[model samples]
Target: MSVRIAVIADDFTGGLFVASNLEKLGIPVFYVCDTAVLHEAADGEVLVIATRLRFMPPARAVAALDGLTTMLDEIGVEHIFYKYCSTFDSTDEGNIGPCGDLLIGKYGQRRLVFGPGYPDLHTYVHEGYMFYKDRLISESIKRSDPITPMNDPDMARVLQRQTAETVGLLPHRVLHRGVEFARGYVDDQQGKGVRYFLMDCVDNDDVATGATIFRHDHITTGADALAIELISQWTSEDAGTRRRTPSPVARAEGGEVVLVGSCSGVTLRQRDHFAQDNPMLDIDICEADEDILMARALAWADEKLGAGQPIGFSVAGDVASVADAQAKFGIMGAARKAEAILAGIAKGLGGRGVRKFVVSGGETSGAIVEALGIQSMQVLPFDELGAGSCISRDARRISLFLKPGKIGAEDVFSAALEKMRAP
Candidate 1:
């Protein structure tokens, strides 16, 4: 039998996207976003699964994980890569005892590689934003964060490490890369195709994936010139196949366009009640399941005619915890939630006259693209992760997206309810 690789996680998009990347590298992929078959492993080389969605009480989550261990043993799953989760806001391991730091101690670290579960940040210079209009072309780069390939420490608090390390990793392609990538982003009527959100790292253990920016004076930019440059790169044959629908015929509408972002519905508290609406749903930061709620949210949107409204929305997901900054924002779970909501909404929006949607969140955008089930995508030179996009037929039903709770939690929601008439 072929060595089967199964990706289990709390969020669907992140797990699936990672699996897809690995698959392109010639790995067979299987996913268990559901808990029912977590232990049901196929014989494989390496298995990557996240623990946050296992959101039962610690004791309960462990029991369930214990059952998974037995299943893994029965299935002969040897190499396992489990995302060692920290406290929601703290980098310390709060509940690893029940989940077996022992087994993982014996096997996980060696078998698993830990880092940011989403896209690495590639900065885009949004022209004409006077706030950033100041000339920093003579900027001196500094070591802002800890070193990379370092020990697995909590990232939320690691400002120095996160910032300094990823500075150069961003695509310098702009200076020496593609021009077409920059064009078609926007027109005068439309806004810039994308924006740049930058930060200097405070602390992130090196060895974590790249693109973890720590701090910042300002974030994000929008400009029309960037769009023209982006669209110039859009050849009819190229973008047509990749588009979520036929590409919008008219000029671009930059930041004004609403995009989908995804995070767990419960984890992403939309209002001041914050953590109250579904306090019952809080799981160990490592143990929440997104499939169930994601399924329901899409269903609710459809039942509610959420697809019909001429609205701009983001389908955000996987808000693991508000406790910590690193885990809270740009984590894999967050990305997964973003992808799932988009998928659910996409399915719901099929043929419903829903046209275009834009994306802001990085990880969520990655999840959306991955969920589209395409082999190779038509991508531009910017931070493809954050590059503004309208996914086509795969998003035929509805467009969904997600972002961290900390970013634009209010302004980004896209759904509107239809008023009811009573006799």
Candidate 2:
């Protein structure tokens, strides 16, 4: 019944994604944002620590993991999973490779497994190159990402530029041979001093095979799919002893607000779709000052606050519009300005009794949550509500539906509101 698995996610939505995957296997998961509460997790529960380090400098990101290994050791955690986006969203100087190197050095492990694929989302890796459906990631919608535009689809080369260690790849052809051959290939690569290993997961079957080969490894890093497969394998080994009581249904009592800050193609489409029925206001980040924008947004929300239908405020726009904003106010400057304006509006809505929040985008979610002073929350099984929905356990009784920028359906906003209000 001791804690066996710990996952360090680089962003809020990624952490919730991993927790939701583990919940699929009925493994109890404690999702926390604050590192100080690591010891508070109950016995037998997996710990998923969500951090806002996705956009931080490599050194700062590595420094944030300073005492995490020691904390996990004290809590009897046997394995560590480093989770990032499926598209391998990182810059040339990364929070992925640098963070992975820190964990490797702390755990004294020779090779760190990297699988940045989630086949369900049409995001998978093959021959060390990442793809979205049939198109290479470099040519996909992710290339337009403002904060971390993925111009290179080669994950091995992408990760190599971030760390000083040698990187290797395990292709799908070798994995198609089976787990035994795949394991031998990985072993051979490690013998040649490859400190990092990226697995080619073109489908769910490849993910399952890779999970089987590394089920008992000291460390396994990837998106949610590999972790889900690994947990399924581990729990099946001793099903009777590993199961824990299911969490109660997560519900909250408050007004609802949908905040959109992602500029991804999917989110832009979702914003347009939701605008057909609900009331939505787009925050202009082009030329307005932060204070003026926040004031204008809050004033607009004052009229739409208690309209029964969920009111939405978005910074999402077409790729051309985003590019225009980036040209006006540098890339990061525009993003930070949008996040600050949204965070301010969230605070204003909270004061007006809006508690059920459906947030779109990773960086936007982090900004809003931190502004609300939320340190931790209990992870709930929200597959029914949507992909990544959960409720806060604090006094506010807030409900959060955190949708990754490029994730969720066109009707995701209305669907989450309907589910949140369902009796």
- Clashes found in each candidate (C-alpha, N, C closer than 3 A): 88, 0
Candidate 1 residues lying further than 4 Å off, grouped into runs, are 1-14, 35-56, 84-93, 96-383, 386-423
lDDT of 2 by residue, 296-376 (tens): 988988888767778899988777888888899888888888899899999888888898898999989888988887777
By summed lDDT, the worst window of 10 consecutive residues in model 2 runs over: 238-247
In model 2, the Cα lDDT at residue 367 comes to 89
In model 1, the number of clashes is 88
Whole-model lDDT values for every prediction? 0.30, 0.83
Worst 10 residues of 1 by lDDT: 214-223
TM-score of 1: 0.35
Which candidate number has the best TM-score? Answer: 2
